[model samples]
Target: MTVAYVAVAVLLSIALVGSGIAKLTRADQVVTSLTGIGVPLGLFPFLATCEFAGAAGLLVGIWWPPLGIAAAIGVVLYFVGAVGAHLRKRDFGGLSAPVVLLLVSAAALVLRLLSR
Candidate 1:
């Protein structure tokens, strides 16, 4: 079960970390994608940085519970916002993937918390 949680965390970290880098580097592309979607381009890098930190926290937390728990929560919060944005865009197709990520992250968090 610990291993399962760790595995989920690792996968989530990969995705969230990559997304952060893209948002930081490709703000224009992100702005275009979120076109007329109300999210400011200026905010992309900030949010991306948080996501990246959360991802790194999750990784470091695996060996250190306190950080991992915090990161897990942070990532889950990030996903909740992601789910909201996707829904707001009426992009049901796009919503599914993020939903899965949210669920997996939530599950992993639960597992980690219980383990401690």
Candidate 2:
């Protein structure tokens, strides 16, 4: 279970960091998707900060269960909001990524809890 948790945490951290970098760089697709969803471009930095923080927490959490648990919770909420945004805009076409990330976040949360 610990091994599983570690693997999931690492995978999630990589995903989050990659996403943060894209947001920070204002990748064309990210900009388009975010603006399409009505998210302000100015908020990109802040959003990236959240992703970076979450990734850091998840990585550090491998040694500290509580931090890892809190990070997982934060990440779950982040993706939940993302999912809601897509749904609110009725943008079903762009919903897959958020939904998949939400599921992955949930899995990380559950695994972290069980591992602890």
Using lDDT as the measure, the top candidate is 2
- In model 1, where do residues sit more than 4 Å from their true spots? 27-29
- Candidate 1 per-residue lDDT, tens place, 1-116, comes to 67977888898889887778878787565656655456777888788888889889988888898888988888888889988998898877666767987997798789779767
Alpha-carbon lDDT, every model: 0.81, 0.94
Candidate 2 has a TM-score of 0.98
Which candidate leads in TM-score?
Answer: 2
Candidate 2: regions farther than 4 A off: none
Residues 20-84, model 2: lDDT tens digits: 99999999999999899999999999999999999999899999999999999999999999999
lDDT of 2 at 18: 93
TM-score of each: 0.84, 0.98
RMSD of each: 2.0, 0.5
lDDT of 1 at 29: 55
